[model samples]
Target: MALIILMLALQFYGVPHSSMFTFIFSGVSFEEILSRQIHLPILWVSYLIIPNFIILDAQRILSKTHLIQLRGFQYSHLQFELISLMGTLFITIIYVLFSFTWIIALMKMTHAQIFSFAGLKEMSSYFLFFLMILIGLICLVLIQATLNLFNSVLGIILPFSWIIFTSFTVWKFNPLNGLMLLRYSSYNTIQTFIFCFIIIIVLTTTFLTVVRKKDFI
Candidate 1:
């Protein structure tokens, strides 16, 4: 309900004349999508809300003992990681589709074409830019899952606090800045994607290590 309300408000009031691409990139031209240095509070808030759902989905996956203990279907820690990842991707995709649906509808009603990039190069760049953003979201989800496995309270408090803090700060020196898609122009798409991919790898290994070290009660 809250997400829907925010999406509607952002569409109508925030960057009403902008294109669907604005939600991902900050600049006016395709080339600047990865080089512009502007902050988008509306996009920031929308992206922040998504991680909360991802965390909840991670928690649900981690909490299910029956799913792990099914007869003849042994699930290892790697399997758990895969399941949680699938859940994260599913949640993120749903949010993206919903946002685009509302955006296209609003675009039609206003009879406006905010940003036009018809060239093959522009389309591919936009796709890569969008992929990097999704990778960041996946990082957050995996981080939440790993934290939850270590300690439940820290799992909830840490990720939520990070989101709250990042939303207010304009500092670029922050280590977790990759999660801030609005300012993604700080680094190119492939660079940020590689950085996020490394984070995911580390988190997955840590999660697996923790799961293996613990004794089942």
Candidate 2:
């Protein structure tokens, strides 16, 4: 409920479509401005809120004795972890779908210039980029969950550490030339898929190993 309201507020006032490129010397069309503004919040939501929710949900599952009892049919920590992963995945999918749908609906209602084919292609590219970032975030959240399971303090520290490191990297090295994939890349379809697969595999493997070795109460 709070998230929904916050998203609505951001849509109205966060970044105005008309003034997006005001400082740039090169003139940008209204369509480009509208598209950029529309997608900006989508990127923000995926990058900021989703990961926090992932960690929070994982923490709830681990900390709540009743939830543990209900979910732990076999009294297995692996089972609990798996359940948490599945739940987090489901929530992430729903959020992605809803955000995309809402953005499309808003564009249509507002008669946004991005309704054309070119705009749609651009939007599709952005969506793909968002999904790639989301996959990485999920992996990071899983790792955090594992840390939280091991020691509550690590859970709190790791997230802040990651945020600070990422912020510094983005500040020092622009996404266009940096290691961040949040910006669109020129990789072909096969290359992109392979890259995403490798990252997901590495992160997931590490997360699983950490969780598997942890001594859960």
Best by lDDT: 1
* Per-residue error (Å), model 1, residue 17: 3.6
Q: Which residue pairs clash in candidate 1? A: none
TM-score (C-alpha) between model 1 and the true structure: 0.64
The local distance difference test score of each candidate is 0.56, 0.47
Look at candidate 2 and tell me the lDDT of residue 57: 43
| Candidate 2, 86-168: lDDT as tens digits | 77667766765665565555444444433233222466655664464455455556555656666766765665565444433
Q: Ten-residue segment with the worst summed lDDT in candidate 2?
A: 18-27
- Candidate 1, residues 108-172, lDDT tens digits: the string is 56544544532213445545545655676667667777777767667656666665555555544
TM-score of each: 0.64, 0.59
Q: What is the C-alpha RMSD of each candidate to the true structure, in Å?
A: 6.1, 7.9
Off by over 4 Å in 2: 1-47, 60-64, 67-72, 115-127, 156-160, 170-182, 187-196, 214-217
Q: In model 1, how large is the Cα lDDT of residue 141?
A: 69
Model 2 TM-score (2 dp): 0.59
